[model samples]
Target: MKNESKELATLDYPGGKRRAKLRIVSDRVATATQGDCLRCARVAVRNLIIDGSRRTLGRVREASTSPGLVILGGNEGQAVRECAISDPCGFTAVHAREGAKLNYPESSPWGWSLANGVSIACHNSIVRDNVLTDCTDTGVVVYCSPGTKIEENHVTTKRRSAIGGILLVDAEPFSRDYSGIMVKGNVLDASGQAMRVGIGIGPSVLSDDMETIINDGSVIGNHLTGDYMGYGIATAGLQGWTIRDNLDDARYMGQPSDRCLDDPVNPPPQAFIYNSATLKESVVQDGFFDSDFAYRECVGLIVEVDVRVPGWWDAQHLENAHSS
Candidate 1:
């Protein structure tokens, strides 16, 4: 189906209700394109049980120069699940450029390949209340998008070699400025998944000589849970970014222990520095990063704690890996 948006378009289940008997199971479900991106900015997709699509369940590709595209799932937690979905990047809902709002409330996107389950590649957008699980790559990634909010979402890694749960990156090729962005109130779980990092702020896996400047940004009130996780929060080269009030719930080497702020020599193992970068005027305070776990080194060499000190610690240089 195509939505030119000469008029507002809404594709929904029968009677605008999600019934178990109703299904939109197809190899290609729906694709909405805005021929004139300036005139229109919203497409509502609701109550759809889109199953087994080789491509995305709902796709919107509009002109970046145009206003924006807002793909709303359903009203007030009525969004249904997109299961057994596949694509080159495994995205259940796809949009392009800036000013896009992806609100998939209570929607679960699973069984994807080689990419993020929910990707907000544009700036000036909002992504909230979606649950991502078992995706081959990251769960939710807001790439180069400033003024964006990633909130109240749940992400879990059940797939081995998954690349973290939630990530905010300047990314590669287009290391745009990410200012006024907020990542708050999200839950990331890596249980026995050997997940790489819980939440991270850095360059993409292939970024080189690229610096992502984030001004007035904040990562707060988020929870990272797991035992076999790598870094609860991994960051590098941040300025004007607030990293606080985030907690990790993992056992100390698989045994319960009451340890807070281990010695700098034996620092808390949940937070780390990924690469060499200057961190100036950023606040890292009032958080809990459990204790050392035997599987703490799951992602290889990393510097733990002291992310506020400039050049105090630096670990592992980024190499050009396959595009994620």
Candidate 2:
């Protein structure tokens, strides 16, 4: 419990399983304004342990207001499971437009964001070894959670509209269903995007309800560097997800050669499945650069693209692969 405004520690309990055990260790929670700076909602916040904390700047430090640790599972129904945000160190950027007005009334200043640098809408949670930096949008975000476990974190984003660096979205409409999720060994760096698992349906829904929002996740061995241009690992309308041994230096600066392209009509072992379990291991890799050359070496070989599921309408296609 350090400097706060709207919240810098909140458990808001109201669901079962002997709820209540919020432990925020080595505190240093930072400045907030429109909320969150450590918020664990509709709690069953059980065994919740935010270790070695240090949530940084909020409230005007960009001003999207909120987030630097937000673990909500609202609408209760119980399930914020064994939470833990280890070795924390979430960083700045939040302003989704303040000086130009339209600060908040939800129209899309990112709908005032659920904000990032660690934001899991709860469920078997576990965001390990954290150290998120310069966040604006995402740097660890797993919304529609389910058996979530984003491991060995170390996200980075050198400001400027930073968007992704470990994101498994579901922007809420509630159908939830991101099975067994587990993005392992993280180390995403970003300027725009890097590692994004999809599902953001909207368009008067109805495609058989799109299997009730399925995203059977499992993105393993992460290590995607970035400079922007997005897509180091993207998926949409997922069915049986499982991208493997990731290690992309985030290339796409207008197709430098193509590292992975596959959107030719829902191709895959029927629809999404890369790297073993008999899916044949391969998760995009092309010489891998980014030491300041911005990001280089991107020829080709592992191209099986087709990623487009931000709002969904009936585009249906996602099964890209890559590796080196």
Candidate 3:
């Protein structure tokens, strides 16, 4: 029983849990306080239809797309356009299920970090044509799925001194198991690390448990800029991981000031290994491993091993190390 005189607000069921708009009115159909929603139409919870359109008033038109933030969507395949959505607890501004979309909008100020911006867990979902900036945390996150089209989305850390950009995660080791995932034509800027995956260590259905877990995947045609604090692409697993056609440049953006003068290549937290990477690909790999870091700090070091080539290193005994 809500107060009739209180402001009447309408939001899409299950979607607008945080009503962006509030209105108070005069009517005895319901009763109670000043900020509660009116429930005059005695309808069951499931049968109740909150007018999602009624809450679209007072929305200032976004002036530009330079910093776009159109956060609107639900589990269904519908259009939630130019919605000034931000900080809905843990949920991103825009989220969609299969065949759903959260379209582009003129950039408006949400004044909140994209703690977790548009998340598309559903297959065949589209998240494109918008400027997603100033998100404090992950942006445009996609989990394990296929037929997901994530393109032309600009995701950046708005903190100015922020760390990292959009994160693509598929913990599953072995790329061949899961078939299709395509991410092309997107811009991610700023942050400590651009993207990360295969967060933990362990064998993922490996021939031997002694090997590390590897995430089988692909990254193609995505532009990453100036977040050298971490590896642009880190895939730490045993096998079935592919890194082809991704770019990161410090020369154009210039290096960060806080970095050390001698070898500014910072440590990447979790790129276990990228076995599929090759010299032919323009992709560059630079970072100091734990052993290298420890050795430098050691004032006194001891122990040496034979440097002679193993008799088994020849073609007569080389097992799987050679591709020929």
Candidate 4:
């Protein structure tokens, strides 16, 4: 499919209706040389499974604005599973936004998302075993949803403006706190940021006293590598979040201290953790580093944490090389 705004396929179920169990398998979906707002596929119904081992989905044109696969909505009991989404454009490969029911309810209606001004929502969804490359924004984006899992995926990007491999944020004003978000077993190799989980500043119609949206989740066992200009992992406005067992090799692309923040008086460390003021009960531990020790040693206090230097053989390869 090419030059269209609508998705190639969309499975949507209306509110207060019987949920549909749909399966889109073994199909090749692509949008090339298209205009704006072009998406490969979308699933809004419940109990949807998209699994095609040989399936290829991409947007070869740079004009594409949306993701390759979009999950708008799903029930709590039903789960949406997407596998093998590959080779997307510079935009997000998989995007799950605030759904219509969440935004257009009769009791209380809220405005569209502050990030992209779109209304979509998803829950109980799992994105796994996918390969996404050359994404401009992010490989996977989950906005204001609960019980979402992103696991076992490989993401790479050449664009330095790219945000990260996986980005989780709260953009809507839902009364309930976003929870059960898990990121694990993924290889994120990018020129910019690697992984970011946080909440943006937005007006919330659901609560008058809520200032900052908080997410309860965990980021674990992911291999993150990126340029020195960005962070391997960044978190903000999170509660009860744990970041552990992850490997980071983020370093300057050119010079040791080039484009990095330098402190003349109090220098930073080689590997360290950052916690925002709004972050409550969050812990970062057991972090393994395979970064450029020579660069860190030269910078002297530009990094604060102690890093373990691996052998030459182990340092030569990235994590899960075959998967990426």
Candidate 5:
């Protein structure tokens, strides 16, 4: 059988929800056999080989459908349990459709993420139990998905342009705009920026119209560290936003600011508040533009900061990573 494709099976849940169990295997690499393993839902699949690169993982979407669950597997060691969900060399475990839910079990022992893992561009889904490190971009990016839930994940990117532990993009293709989302219970550390926004990512008519707004969401109980760029929790092109109880965004200078004033246009701004949290120096500081970005008419402005910094020097020293 061709292993580099999705294996689909139907399951019956009593009085719950109509759910399908799927396992993606690589035909070229090691393939999984069928068995009654307790780890999966029912009549589960086994032994999905971890192929060398991202192209192998894309095969899993061969038999894609609607709102089913996806689990990412890897090869050797505790990689299925220890490393980030996918290899850092490329974008792995990516399935983009409308209305899909997925989960990845990961571990980050290195204090930094080495790859990108388990990105879901679908709408109205949940992403949980993921540990991502060293990804050059976002750990998990959500684009133009309404009523989405991003919870209980750890993202650490030590590389350049490391934006968004869990990013939300409401850009060009998002015709209806992005609203009613929740980002809660995550650890984001040492990335260039955290939770960036932009949208419209497909062969559709409105992909360019995705630059919209987000509304009616919550950002709670996240541990944000080592981001001297824009914000711990940022929302662009939206209104009616809420950010509460994100206490871990700190600085070495001992003071915390809400945001490091950066580019204002393109990605619009959302509401930000510091709750029972601390702020130092400036709750929101500015002039934080990407040194490499060549865009025109780009000015820097910081807004809606919910600063959780403990002291002054703690927050100021965060800039050292860039100058070096």
Candidate 6:
């Protein structure tokens, strides 16, 4: 705990576990009244509350732009945020889940590199029961962390980015496959700022060629309520994902539909799927096997596959074979 100023208190782990192995339970309280609240790597945190609104006494306001809470790599824990307002720093401008700089291969056409949100690289962790507001970046994000449960959280972002609120993605050097992350019962509010999507699943910012394929995860029972939310939920470069029972709370938001009249071309429905043609020739048929949403507000789901972007690994494999 901290008073007006002067270092009030400090809580340090006595070096028992490297990556959140020992579980510590307490109703007590600890506080850091200054810069960099908590950075957890392989540690377990439960029933903890982090408010990014707190800042050092005399520091510049820019200090708040830094990450309020960051969990680099761990196996188990729960992280919730009261508020996180950050600027476009490094490669995290796109805000694709965890903030990491992704460097593309020279042969790739997308670009040399791009940034994402702050990195919360953990697996099987529980990010639940938290409330975040006005986060320019992603509200709750996990990087290459599978089997994580993002549930029962309330996120309100006043600003808009390419991706916002409750995202699960992978941003490693090489391509990888992961599954079993569950996103359920989260309330995403964009009434103030209007977000692009409430919850985003699969691939960081670089899914054009399928660098990462998230499979068998579930996005269920999540509600999206806000103004002009392009898609309540959006998925790209993913397969075998169970998307069910999710709805767009347009009635609550006093909106008849999610599409906007200003946009010339009709925007996709509440649930949007991009790059389906690239994923598989017939992967997206009349209805997806693992998805079930029957609501006018939800518009079931829509898949738009851009054929221009070359399949990343598919091209790489062909080039490697020719070289060999």
> Which segments of candidate 3 are over 4 A away from where they belong?
1-76, 97-114, 160-164, 170-178, 191-217, 227-229, 238-242, 251-324
TM-score for all predictions?
0.61, 0.27, 0.45, 0.49, 0.47, 0.51
Candidate 2's TM-score reads: 0.27
Winner on TM-score (2 vs 3): 3
Best by lDDT: 1
**What are the Cα lDDT values of the candidates?**
0.46, 0.37, 0.32, 0.37, 0.35, 0.39
Q: Candidate 2 at 218: error in angstroms?
A: 8.6
Model 4 TM-score, all chains together:
0.49
Lowest lDDT block of 10, candidate 5: 315-324
Could you tell me the lDDT of residue 181 within candidate 1? 78
Candidate 2 C-alpha lDDT tens digits along 88-130: 2233222111111111110001112323544555555555655
Off by over 4 Å in 5: 1-51, 54-84, 88-92, 99-116, 158-161, 172-177, 191-211, 227-230, 252-324
Q: List ranges where model 6 is wrong by over 4 Å.
A: 1-119, 158-162, 171-175, 204-212, 251-269, 278-324
Cα RMSD (Å) per model?
Answer: 12.6, 18.2, 19.1, 13.5, 14.2, 16.3
- Candidate with better TM-score, 4 vs 5: 4
| Ranking 1 against 6 by lDDT, winner | 1
Ranking by TM-score: 1, 6, 4, 5, 3, 2
Candidate 1 — number of clashing residue pairs?
A: 0
Clash numbers, per candidate: 0, 18, 20, 15, 44, 12
How close to the true structure is residue 206 of candidate 6, measured as C-alpha lDDT? 21
Off by over 4 Å in 4: 1-97, 100-120, 159-161, 173-176, 191-211, 226-229, 253-273, 286-324
Superposed Cα deviation of residue 123, candidate 6 (Å): 1.6
